[model samples]
Target: MDYERQPYRRCGRSGLLLPAVSLGLWHNFGEGKPVDSQRAILHKAFELGITHFDIADRYGPPIGAAESAFGRIFPRSLRDEVVITTKGSNPMWDGPYGKGNSRKHLLATLDRSLTRLGLDYVDIFYLHREDAGTPLEEQVATLDHMVRTGRALYAGVSNFSPEHTAEAARLLRDLGTPLLVHQPPYSLLDRRIEGSLLGVLEQEGVGCVVYSPLAQGLLTDRYLGGIPAGSRAAEGRFLTPDRVTPEVLAFVRSLAELASARGQTVAQLALAWALRDPRITSVLVGASSPEQLEANVGAVDGLEFTDEELAAIDRAAKEAGVEA
Candidate 1:
């Protein structure tokens, strides 16, 4: 439980400091997984100084399972020591009020999220995704309300385009909420954020906590040889076997070689690459086991990259059809 083993970074212009690597309870903290195993991963991650834990209303396989499981294992005594964040705006229930950025939907979902997490207030609550059907003013207002009412300390958004992000930040600022962070998918295979989202975050002084830094396990060694049984791809959950094409395998092999030369694993190399940008407040990683979490956190040890290595990484990504 050496807190000093991990490095902490300022979350944009906020007073909060997040670990370079955070744990995401998207996959492993769901039903069918043993409670003890989930607890072990959470404990191990905290011990490694990963204070931020990201969850969503629709994270579990059936939905709401991750939060329920987390509530069972996370001790109330450590609530103040960690940063707990959850998201909404995705489909979670039936009928019209099930999803979206509407005030009713957002507020109602947060209540349910709090009930499930067994927390009086979350450190940060994010709009899981932009609901174009709802006006930006309404969406931002709901987030502001969450913070002002003590339901959440900070507000954030995820999967928002650069234009949308700018507008949302403006609206939140106008309401005196001040957007805290933005969660987006970022990795070697997906560099869409580099085009403008990162710039907007930097300009707006909003923290960037990126998820899927491993490309849903694509950047890891799990698919180096082939998709192993019980893997995400094999299970057809988020990642499919078709995505492990020969070209992708080749790209990953190149990365593996580069990682080996640097005395690190491919997964670590990818995590480090994502965190290479100073705008990135933290990289959210998912783990099925405590050992896996430890390996991902190792990425922080090699966050720096040489000029040549960066060029080589771009070359490999472009060759694999990535628009980097």
Candidate 2:
């Protein structure tokens, strides 16, 4: 593997350096997908210098399937070379303790995740989302315990508002387990983070690793003509068919034109745009195939954008009713 092919960036003020394009096992690494295919994608991602792999306990259709699949292919020799991250806080089992940010739930979930991944400890363990029922102190303390107990090397949070993120960072810092990263959804279609969340991460010295960089394949050419037979939208999982409205298609077409001029795919353009901000440590990408992974990672080559191109991108987004 050409490690230098993909540049590594420091995650905020932390000593950890994650690949600019990390692989996420949110969609394809489940039981439905073939094991050999999943293995191919994982191998190809590592071959392309993607050392970070992100997963969540509730990522699979039945939950815990992705981790199990990953465990089957993950080589023990390469454990030291790769960064494995998993999250909790979503419902994964029966009973009230099945999911929450409480200490009981988080600790139990981490143990189960480790068993599924066949790992003693993950590089990062995140509270998947904010749980209002649980006090912020308890939630933050749970993360601290995870790190302090050697179950996780670092702590992270996902889908957190700016206020929650700031408080968590402060609490974790006081506990001597500084927040390492914040994972949020970001893309041309969704620029919600541009207003406040990104600012908080920068001020708090928390690295920002964004997911949905391709907007669940909307930013790509796959939906240019319309949703295909077996697409994410068709399955009505996270993205619905109604999301492929005419306005969204028009927005995608405009970006596709811009991408053509730059000799990049629309997906690559979206990834590059998300990574354009220095505050962004990495952009998590999900690939169903090795070819797709290669194409997405190529975004690193054209990370720069001319002022005029940036202006045009903003104009397209604004015209498509995307708020800045």
Candidate 3:
């Protein structure tokens, strides 16, 4: 696919090079969408220079469906051409060993994920979330084991706080396995990471693959006029109608206007803003259609920002309560 045509960034100190924009299967690519439709998105993303596809056990509605569906369309020719990341630590089944960061659950889920992915090993495997009930040492050891045993080439952590991330990095370093990446939600509407997480990752030399860079589509023009029919908000799942409040919509509209001035869509602007951080390895995005994916890929075309534009974005984001 000549994916190298696009510049890839090193994941922290690791040798892994991920595209600036990665596709995420956190939404869509599941049972609700037709198999062919999902396949088209994957094809289009690959053609656009995206090499990373993020997946998790609990992504699809029925859970595990996203990985299974993606596995079905995953071409053997492209397997080595791309980087596939799957996660555990979220509940996909009932019972004591069904979820959490316990070695038992993490390893079992990795095996199941490998079977569903139709691959012996993933490019990266993540501990989907922190388990308050589990000890940090145990979780880090489990991830280290995954890499040692060749079930995953690298290890990552997601939805972890800055403090936890720092500790995890320390543990992984001692085990001779540095934390490869951390997946967190970061957008104009969500800047919690900037307060501390970003610095931690940079200091620890851990790359970041941020998800929800579009704030669940609130940063896009799609919700400018209000939630459209069949949209995630209208469906009242991850993004409910109530979440698209007057304040948030107002913020989205303002961002859209600024994007128009830059001759870019709101989605593109948000994505480019995310990549502005040198510590960010990639901005993980999810698409409902091929067109959406194409537009997102365009984000890379114009990522430059003048000081004035950066200030304006900061002002708008603060006004929108992103900093609050």
Candidate 4:
């Protein structure tokens, strides 16, 4: 709960300085989770100076539930103290303009998001994904309009490839509302961003807020032994028990050993590894409990890595065939 414990990093060339580690409502804080649990995690996050909270229109089990829950737990007076980012462009309902990067869909979703979040303007509004059917120009223009109309303070894109991100960055820059951040998946078990996306973001001066930094809990001590009861691998659709094969367990054990030598957990080591890249503005992590959130935020303390440790990490990750 110490404010000075979390450090802030500049978002690209923008004036915004976001916390080194951000929280995402991608999992938990939804329909299935209790309201009291969601409130506790969110309250603890803010108390720890984790000012950025990420969410999407389609994040909840039943779409729009996450933002609605946040609206209930987050007081209007303290809204200015935190950075709220809600994404659209993902299908949330049945309609012609329910999904896509089209101007109509984007604007309609923004209005719905605002109403659900109980806010006049969000800190950042992102187009959740790339739509091959829609032109990039239409998408950027719509996001530009959101900022111009005071519906969103900044615009961003998520799950876009390096090529798409480059094009979108150019378009948004031309529109005078430069792309603020790109939310991508980058973790010890997934280093695809290092191949080219990281370079692209750096060249364009667009900050990156990486998601799944713990590889959906793969790069954690939780799976070192096996999938425990109620773990994401056992219950979540994204990560399944079958995905955690013997080979993965071996790699996880090695990584956990390395983390132990450093007096940290695998989750902390994974987060620290992701932060090693300067291009990464923040690592967006999700938590089901307040204790988990606190442990993750403590990762900032052991962020320093020796050259030998970095090399060992790369070797282990490469052996797992997870490198980009």
In order, the Cα lDDT scores of the candidates are: 0.91, 0.93, 0.89, 0.89
Per-residue error for 68 in candidate 1, Å, reads 0.5
In model 3, what lDDT does residue 226 have? 81
Best by TM-score: 2
Q: Residues 49-149, candidate 2, lDDT per residue (tens digit)?
A: 99999999988866999999899899889999999999999998899999899999999999999999999999999999999999999999989999889
How does model 1 fare in lDDT? 0.91
- What shift in Å separates residue 265 of candidate 1 from its native position after superposition? 0.3
Which pairs in model 3 have colliding backbones? Answer: none
Per-residue error for 177 in candidate 1, Å, reads 0.6
Number of residue pairs clashing in candidate 3, backbone atoms closer than 3 angstroms, sequence gap of 3 or more or interchain: 0
Candidate 3 yields a Cα-based lDDT of 0.89
* Alpha-carbon deviation at 249 in model 3, angstroms: 1.9
- Scored against the true structure, residue 18 in model 1 reaches a CA lDDT of 93
RMSD of 2: 0.9
RMSD in Å for model 4: 1.2
- Please give the RMSD to the true structure for each candidate, in Å: 1.0, 0.9, 1.3, 1.2
- Minimal lDDT window, size 10, model 4: 315-324
User: Could you arrange the candidates by lDDT from highest to lowest?
Assistant: 2, 1, 3, 4
